[model samples]
Target: MVKKVTALKPKDESISAYVRDLIEKEHRARANREAAVVYQEFLDKNPEECAAMEVWESAPLSDEIEPRKP
Candidate 1:
């Protein structure tokens, strides 16, 4: 589940700035939706390539894990 936390009003007192921020947020959301559609279409066209491309890469942090001894 996703949750949103609203930010407290900043000291900048400019309505124009607020409107600009809303516009930017809307544009970003629209772009993400469009990209999702394109990605789906690509996967439909090339399932094998898409499967290969879908691998997620990340680096591990914090070497903290319960150590086991054999």
Candidate 2:
């Protein structure tokens, strides 16, 4: 008895577009990992500063900035 094999079809998206999207995703992931490591190190060295930053971020921002007269 002989067995029949089926071939898989390609997606509708273009190969270049798919590859570009994949590269962008990989780049973003790498950037995020690097940022996380840097942030972790910053937190380790300046725990107080990190807490202060969180507080500042949570505080409401002023909508108007005062202009200085020259």
Candidate 3:
């Protein structure tokens, strides 16, 4: 595991930095999954509202829509 971490870390990055980055990414992904499960449960409990949301979600954006600047 140490060898893999050393191999993957950037040339100038510390091992701890690389490991911290990996931990943060996994934490965010797990959070997203948990939020999705909660959202699905809410939708399952509200069929009418879910159907309305689905209709809106399926609609295409206009061609004139522009990306927001940072």
Best by lDDT: 3
Spell out the clash pairs found in candidate 2. none
In model 3, state the lDDT of residue 12. 97
Q: Which of 2 and 3 is ahead in lDDT? A: 3
Ranked candidates, highest lDDT first: 3, 2, 1
TM-score, candidate number 1: 0.58
Score residue 69 of candidate 3 by CA lDDT: 96
> Which regions of candidate 3 are displaced past 4 Å?
63-70
lDDT tens digits, residues 14-56, model 3?
9999899999999999999999999999999999989999999
Q: Model 1 off-target regions past 4 Å?
A: 1-11, 54-70
Better of 1 and 2 by lDDT: 2
**Mind giving the per-residue lDDT tens digits that candidate 1 earns over 31-64?**
9999999989988999886767666333345658
- Residue lDDT tens for model 2, 1-70: 1111112223575556666776899999999999999998998899898899899899778667779989
Q: lDDT (CA) for every model shown?
A: 0.70, 0.75, 0.94
Clashing pairs in 1: none
